[model samples]
Target chain A: MSPAQHEPDEDPGAPASSHAVSAPGAPSAARPKVPRRVAWRRLSTISRARLSRGTLLAALLTLVLGLALVAQVRSTQTADLENLRETDLIALLDDVTDRADRLEDEVRSLEQDRSRLESGGGDAAAAQAAQSRLESYQILAGTVPVSGPGVSVRVSDPEGEVTTTMMIDLVQELRDAGAEAIQIGPARVVATTWIGVDEGRLTVDGQPVAAPYSVVAIGDGHTLAGALAIPGGFNDSVRRVGGEVQVTEGEELVIDAVHEPPTLEHARPVPPSEGR
Target chain B: MIPVLGLVVGVVLGLMLQPEVPGWLEPYLPIAVIAALDAVFGGVRASLEGIFNDRVFVISILSNVLVAGLIVFLGNQLGVGAQLSTGVVVVLGLRIFSNVAAIRRHLLGA
Candidate 1:
């Protein structure tokens, strides 16, 4: 379109002159062979332009392919994260299962030991030895059921104002007062149970507590009551925190309960002669 | 022209030799091949730029080494270090193909 571009078309060396006919209606002499080489060179130039354009298209395709690969890598990373979480869950479940199996084996062994002792001739010496062994096992199990006359402290709110921390603190006080086998509501208290707020209610073992938490202990009832009555005891703390704690005693407080603890799966059975 | 043809033939041979070998030697082979290709490409770029200097060659070599090392490190950290080291192989494959094509077109120009 520019004047400078038109000047090239008019140039004698230009490729356009290879096809140029001089006058519109007059017969012209045949052209020499030199312009034919120019035409071939021009054709080569056109082919080079087409090849360059094709290369550009290839470059564009390569870019698109790289982007698709990046998307695939991101999706794979997400899947890997999910697999890690599943691996953790499986490991935890395996641990719990292993513990349960150990407990089952211990129960089986104890039942067998007891049966052996009862079936064996009731010699005084053997009975004494077996009783001693049973006592030792009970101590090791942390579940030696103790029954005696002691005080039972019941803390509750008829209007429901008791907090979980208050309940935990109260349990701690009872524990300090030498209460064995403490249970709040239906959930049997253990060493590792984490007491926390669940929903709007105070809960242990996933069970919600209604009012009046009954806490029973097997010890000297008078001594236990005195211990709670002392300053900084559960009663004092409860009163200071505006919570209720009441203590009473009876001739006998039986804690007829059994805690089936977790079992171990992979441990070989302990030889009876090997003592810890 | 013979150098270009030799480079092409060497790359083809290397690609053919890859899978038949064990994995422990695999990493070194690809890295060596890539380094060699990078040197060849640097030579061509330097000739085009018409200013040959050791500095450009050194920088190119350093960059190639760093990039290849980083890719391998990332692959290892992502837990597919051994199995999917083919990522490095694929990149090398693309580079070799493009380099061979470029050399061929230049030698057989319009």
Candidate 2:
């Protein structure tokens, strides 16, 4: 490598003359004018490239690694399980336990009913009537799982702007559309059901519900869906509050939620003849 | 120069596409990325030392990712996945630091 080819002020301690040997041209006034340092940096990078093809290969590999790093970081950060704190873990465990208990109780009661029906110890007609009455009571009490043709409504508040009033209005609209049985998330909506905001989160019967909230109502699917899509109905209200409502009509919608039956403390059934 | 351009393009593509890594591969991705980073830093250091070899760099990159993943997989099979993952990360992290230090000294003359 010639002395003139190398910049006099380039790093004297640079390990090798490979850069000078591979430099495209010595700095000259006639050449396209760039600052000496910039030219030196560019030439050095080019010279490094000329030394071996490995530098380019390494760059490509680094590029891929960079992309993977960014993607992995994002995925890891967004992972819900990974971000769970101790309280969140405990809450998840509680939820699982509650669900398991509910299912077990349901199975046990259903097995008992089947055994009673198969034994045939009672009068068939009277037993049938009693069974039908029990089912009606269970449905009214919201203590029995119900499934039939209905509409499923999903509400999402992406901006956290949905208020309690909007949800109340939604429920009222569903009832007006003749919703026989309704469920919001895991809570069954009944006469005693309470919906409110607790600490900025929507809660049903004191249990926090997360978005997007799925509401399943057993009723006339077309009527229920139409009710939500009316000119200034639930859908419009959701939009006005920076939320979204998606209503889907389906032939079979299952709402397998059972609420605790309310106990009557003061009120009693009046004698048949004395009823006002 | 071409490699740098490729790198920029790769980043843009990654951002635009946002490809999902499979759930099964998620566990190994972080380790693989760290191992690849170690190889990249080592390559930079070697280049500054005038001993950069493309074949060696490529081989190291492949081996690093494979070996890191293998260690984690084996650890999972043996019921010690978390411990072994930590071990792999610590070792690779040290190597990355040393290589980065070398590169800094070479570039900054400090």
Candidate 3:
């Protein structure tokens, strides 16, 4: 376009307005004054109006440009987790595995608890079952003194000839008759009780016993008495050893002797939710 | 004055819209943006040089973005996306730098 409106030194900022003379910075101070009407006329020119229309269209395209830019920035920040060292990746994998393990454990425990709760028939039934089991353990373990309908045996050994073997046979005979508890002399008889002779003394679990030994068994009284009187049984064995055996059936025989239950050293309960 | 005003309005509009780019378009967006930036700088430099043409400026920006995106897409199909993207970025970056330098020179008269 011929550079028709040439000036000696046009201000850079004055180009967009297309009126270098109207520059407000250095030129305004140097010249002191310029016609505001002429400046306005130059601004309202037809060529400038045409350029303005084209600029509007160009700026519309920039809208897409701006949007794309922001989206790219956002995507970069939030995703693209692929870039990492191997150790970091492994650590992330480990974290995920640990979380999965914890969730699996929780799932297993919840499933077991749900099944137990459903089958237990309710709070009352569960409590009753627990109480029954506790009583059984107490009696079988000889941790508590037990009284029930059973039979009592009196051995009158005037010759002091009732050996440990005879006493053991009597206890075995009582157990076979469904006897839940037994007391021989001053000692309580349990699964772990030992009848042995120590220093030539008839000892029941390390305690010496004298003549006239009384054995109390808590079970069906007739059943225990019949077992003691069976042919070639506890009565025959004691009689053969020159000891007189007297068996008496009673409804309320008491085995007041109690023993300490041994503590477990190595055994443990298995986990209920093993497969899960 | 109007051109710069239009650009500012476009930026404001883009911010307000914040539209989501589709999956297919994601890979090429960065390339396209860089190409558009190159065109914008060229246009500004040309305007400072008093050789600014409305049709040329518009066509340059539109064609630059499209051609850059197309190149990246073709490179992806040929399994050279990474290399091609780097090459395209380097060329566009050089052009943008030269244009900006020219713009700076024009503005400062240095």
Candidate 4:
């Protein structure tokens, strides 16, 4: 190709002239060329168009929904905490009710025993046996002081994500392990007692188990520990889901005194031989 | 917006009416209705697309019902039935997210 044909299109002065003028004045002159408002408007329109109405609505809805979800979760947690509190109180009330009924029964039984003792009747031996049984029950209730070297076990459900059933299973296992005396959240260990869940929350006795369920029992520490660590023990299951089971040996684990059980004074007194 | 509004209204109405209704049927019907509607709409669309497997639908339906049932049952058993219901509500809140996401994807192709 001819040099003229290849290069003839260039305006030799065009580059220099535009460069000199545009370099110094270009920025200042162009400053107002596209106003800030116009640029912003263009950008806003582009973004608005790119983000469709449906998507925006969906996003906004999702945001509101997410907030609601968070609120719901928080409220749930709070309610669970409150329920935990109430469960303890209910357990306490139940214990008290049971105690009152038991005391009435015991007083009546004692009156019968007193009459039999005074009568110097053949049922005297039988009356003594009844009295012994009553004593044991009273000890079990913590109304009478019974002391021995035993371990205390505490089993508590964790603060978050622990179920009531799991706590009950643990308590049962402990009792099976020969825990002489056990205290769950607030419920004292007793023959008629069963671990109960209240409001998605579990309580022992009459106390709320704040997370990390505290299962306190009085028994042989070694035996209790072994029982809890067995294959089907509370320890194994608790460990499966990152829970804690602690055992401590002590010289004394004084269960605060509980009330006496009731007896039916109206129950017929059997003959000594028959009672034996 | 419309769906959210509908949900809010429905929830409020159900909550207000709950106390006035008979004890036995009052608690279950509202939740069951919502779940049913969700399943019906979801199933119709998925089935038309040949993606509605019986197993998936059954499992989802059973799980949803079980959760609702357990919340009520546990709450009653524990004497904290209301609190457990709160947990159920949290799960429902999550379902709302998934539902909204599905709707958005279907309508906007995004």
Assess each prediction's global lDDT (C-alpha) against the native.
0.53, 0.74, 0.72, 0.51
**Candidate 2: lDDT of A226?**
93
Q: What are the runs in model 1 whose C-alpha is more than 4 Å off? A: A1-123, A132-146, A158-161, A265-276, B1-110
Candidates sorted on TM-score, descending: 3, 2, 1, 4
Candidate 4 local lDDT, A1-276, one digit each (tens): 222233221111111111111211123231113333443443344234334453344334333333333333344454433334456768988999999999999999999999978777677787899999998767676565455656666544463555666777766776777777766544566765655556666655544556655556677767777777788667777767666667677777666535345575776889999989
Ten-residue stretch with the least lDDT total in model 4 chain A: A12-21
How good is the docking of model 2, as DockQ? Answer: 0.12
Better of 1 and 3 by DockQ: 3
Residue-wise lDDT of candidate 2 within B51-98, one digit each (tens)?
555677677788889999999899878878778988889867656665
> Please, what are the lDDT tens digits per residue for candidate 4 over residues B12-59?
544444323333634443454444334334432233222333444444
Give the share of true interchain contacts found in each model.
0.00, 0.29, 0.26, 0.00
Most lDDT-accurate candidate: 2
Model 2 per-residue lDDT tens digits across residues A1-276: 433253321221233323321122223332223344543464387454353465567567767886787778777767877534445778999999999999999999999999988777766798889999999788867998999999999998899887778878878999999998999989999888888999999988877888999999999999999999998888998898788888999898898999987688988999989986
DockQ-derived CAPRI band for the predicted complex in model 3: incorrect
Task: Name the best candidate (by DockQ).
Answer: 3
lDDT (Cα, tens digit) per residue for candidate 1, span A110-215? 9999998877766788779999998755533435555668777888575566777777876676677676656576666666555766777778766777667777
Residue pairs with clashing backbones, model 2: A54-B54
lDDT of 3 by residue, A172-224 (tens): 88999999899988899987789888777788888887779888899988899
- Residue A75 of model 4, lDDT score: 41
**Can you give the lDDT of residue A211 in candidate 4?**
64
Off by over 4 Å in 2: A1-43, A46-56, A81-98, A106-276, B1-5
Candidate 3 wrong stretches, greater than 4 Å? A1-131, A158-165, A192-203, A206-208, A236-243, A260-276, B1-62, B72-86, B96-110
DockQ of each: 0.03, 0.12, 0.19, 0.01
